[model samples]
Target: MPRPRFWGEALRDDESGSAALEFIVGGVVLLVPIVYLIVTLGMIQSHALGVEAASRHVARAVSSAEGAEDADARAAAVLDSIVREYDLDADTLDVDVSCVGDSTACPAAGETLRVTVAASVPLPLVPPVLGLQDATRIGVESSSVQKVSRYWRDG
Candidate 1:
């Protein structure tokens, strides 16, 4: 008995589709992680930039000789400006500003002025893929030393 011609043709054709199938599977496997990494880094960069701006504003305000208490209002104004500049909702963000100045002021010269901002945002296809059902919450903190001008105090 001899094998049928149809059977031999069918086996040869089966091997033809195998390469196409492998390429599709490999593409899907490689694409997923690359996409995830790009998204994660982008999110982190945005948060960091916002924080850097906030910290600079707070530091400039606190460095003035008026007093640390006066800096509080200035800090709030700076934070509001950041929210507007970044197009982020005010309600979604929390800002905390701490200043250190003269003895009567914050009692620590050259000390840190810290600004912290936190926000919660939805991460599309990220949390779910990681088996998480909730949105991601990101927090950023930036600190700078107060720079008091001697000329201002002397005048």
Candidate 2:
């Protein structure tokens, strides 16, 4: 007959499966934060890329347009398309258009058209309560400068 073990004897017995249990528990504790970090980084990087693309395309469209009205239309179109494609929040998006010349008018002939795009990306799992999401948001910005063609005209 097998001998019945006392509580002390049971405690002294070789621990089976303890390593697996510890590994599972430890892995879960470490893995959750690691995964969250990766997801948050991905979101920030996507927003950065989106802002960059928006600036570049907007500058290009403005510089290439034939007139001020055309330039406005082109910039708006490009910004809208990039915002949609990158899943960026238009409400938080800010765009600045300027000219690197003595004249304040943008996209002038022989001038540099500068387009700056900025946006905020909310962190993953951030709660909207108490404006925590807004407080925890990461800001991303990008600027692009394109030279306007010397032949550029306002028709």
Candidate 3:
């Protein structure tokens, strides 16, 4: 009889639901920003990878080409392809291609090709926290350099 009374009193004193509620609130508070940050970082990283790929594409084209004019066109085409493939707006990307250490009016050997791609990546869900109406913009810049191939010397 005494044990039963003690068990009933313990059950009445227990506050199990309180812990569940606290856990729920805490989980929500901690999980939301963590998820947002992860998504934002993923988006930024994806943009960075795209920029790097574009830079490498242009640099390789320039290194293998006989002149800057053709290389420039190839670079533009590569960039456009990347933008379309990644579903990124063309206006958001800024691409620049140039030859390094070229003193002549035309593309030359012993020179390096440089390509830089910059873009603004949108954050996933941070705008509401900052009281802004638009998504947060993150800037990504990638550059690549390629040494002129020896075969270009004959051209």
Candidate 4:
């Protein structure tokens, strides 16, 4: 027969399985949140890339355009196409255009044109609302600049 042990002896014994069990439990406690964080960051990063690409395309489109009306039309089309391609929320996007000589005025030939796009990437877990007017969200923005043709004159 085995000798009887004291109250604390079982817990302190050289057990092979208990340590492994504890390690697994502790690892699970520590790893789950880390995994979730990684997933969230990856999702946000994809959306950020989409916004950056969209901004660059819009800037290039606007820079090559002739007049303010043409630029606006090109920008609208480019933004819509990009948003569809990236599967991003169109309502959450904000656009800003800046010209070298006059910030608000149309970009003349050879002028530096800048386009900025800002979007909110929704979190993994959040309450969905009918409209995002008041909802707090993660903000991501990208800016792109392009120079218009120096020699070509718009008629």
Clash totals for all candidate models: 0, 0, 0, 0
TM-score of each: 0.60, 0.88, 0.74, 0.77
Local distance difference test, each candidate: 0.62, 0.91, 0.75, 0.83
Q: After TM-score superposition, what is the CA distance of residue 133 in candidate 3 from its true location, in Å?
A: 6.7
| Residue-by-residue lDDT tens digits, candidate 3, 22-67 | 9999999999989988987887888888888888887888778766
Order of models, best lDDT first: 2, 4, 3, 1
Candidate 4 residue-wise lDDT at 73? 93
Model 3: what TM-score?
0.74
User: What ranking of all candidate models by TM-score puts the best one first?
Assistant: 2, 4, 3, 1
After superposition, the stretches of candidate 1 with alpha carbons farther than 4 Å from their true spots are: 1-14, 65-73, 87-94, 99-104, 107-122, 126-138, 149-155
Candidate 2 stretches with Cα past 4 Å from truth are: 1-13
Clashing pairs in 3: none
Q: For residues 44-148, could you state the per-residue lDDT of candidate 1 as single tens digits?
A: 677667767776776677566355455667777888888778655567666665545434444145554555556554454654656463436555556555555
Top candidate by TM-score: 2
lDDT of 2 by residue, 20-66 (tens): 99999999999999999999999999999999999999999988888
Deviation of model 1 at 39, angstroms: 0.9
- TM-score of candidate 2 on Cα atoms, chains taken together: 0.88
Residue-level error in angstroms, candidate 2, position 2: 21
How do the residues 39-71 of candidate 4 rate in per-residue lDDT, one tens digit apiece?
Answer: 889878988998999999999988887676777
